[model samples]
Target: MNNISNKIKLRREQLNFSQEYIAEHLGISQPAYVKIEKGVTKLDFERLLKISEILEIDINELLEKQYIVNNFKNSDSSTAIGMVENLHQENQKTNELLIQTLFSQISDLKEENKRLISILEKLSSNK
Candidate 1:
């Protein structure tokens, strides 16, 4: 299934909710809900927000921007907090690596430009 569809299905299953239950809440048929989980139906913003409310999850979780669903079944607040902290740390590390790579690329481009300018200057001098 697609990423969003998979997230929806996973969240529903985590909540022990049936397709019929979700469909009823959405004012749609069970088949339509099934299509949503199966990635056959495209969810609009409003529908997605509704589903997120019914699932008791943040919309960003369904969009795969944040991953807090793994802690849904945990009753321990400390454990949930730890999980969120870990995710935040991981995201920070990823962002740092990305910034470093971008800076390196920029440095390389600046060196290339300098070399090209020197070459142009030499050609002009010859002319």
Candidate 2:
């Protein structure tokens, strides 16, 4: 399991939401909702969406492996810190890739715009 249930519980606590509040939103009993947070019950897509909404988080945030890794704890403090550092490095790489992609897209658009402008200039000069 991904320990998503623990993440849900942590988010709920952070938001100060009671289990009853979540249960009411899900149209289930408090105990049933508790089961969901405790990983005893599997969440369907619809329910997962509802829970994400209630937590004011994106579904991707709830399901992200990075989030799970970030929350991981070990008895050894050094190991836990090392794991977090590794995740941060991975995130930096992902961010760098996204920035590179965006710059490439902007360059492509500028080239296309220049080509269109040149064509328009030629047409106007002929006129």
Candidate 3:
């Protein structure tokens, strides 16, 4: 459907399963799976329960963030985005570490490349 929607779809797809496969397990028709994937039809209780069980997801995931249930709240799309962004930003220090590592790799590769170039030049000169 959408990127956010597709993220959910991709999660289902990550197990190398198909919509029909999931529908069969859910005891629903293939068309129903299509409808759910397209976001045209709301997920029924039975399907939701099955989805939660199969996907190992929380039921609150389907609802809006403001709707708290059982002392847990759902995260809306914006909230999810913000949370992810926050997490990534929190990893900026880690990125600095990765950058140093990448620089070291680049330095190693440069030395290897120089060695290879020297060998190639020597071979070409002999030829």
What tens digits encode model 3's per-residue C-alpha lDDT throughout 27-117?
Answer: 8899977777786764434455577566666655533123234322566777867766754653553346456667877899999999999
lDDT of 2 at 35: 88
> What's model 3's lDDT at 33?
78
TM-score per prediction, in order, is 0.51, 0.52, 0.41
Candidate order by lDDT, decreasing, is: 1, 2, 3
- The parts of candidate 3 lying over 4 Å away from their true place are 1-8, 62-127
Give the Å shift of residue 45 in candidate 3.
Answer: 3.1
lDDT, candidate 1, 1-127, per-residue tens: 5667888999999999999999999999999999999988866656887999999999877764455575567558887787678657755654564566678778999999999999999999999
The alpha-carbon deviation from the true structure for residue 122 of candidate 1, after best TM-score superposition, in angstroms, is 77
Q: How far off is residue 94 in model 2, in Å?
A: 22
Q: Which lDDT tens digits does candidate 2 get at residues 5-124?
A: 878998999999999998999899999988898788866555777899999989777765554644555437887778768667755654564566678778999999999999999999
Q: Count the backbone clashes (under 3 Å) in each candidate.
A: 0, 0, 0
Worst 10 contiguous positions by lDDT, candidate 3:
63-72
What TM-score does candidate 3 reach? 0.41
lDDT of each: 0.81, 0.78, 0.63
Off by over 4 Å in 1: 65-127
Cα misplacement distance, residue 22 of candidate 3 (Å): 0.3
Per-candidate RMSD, Å:
13.0, 10.6, 15.5
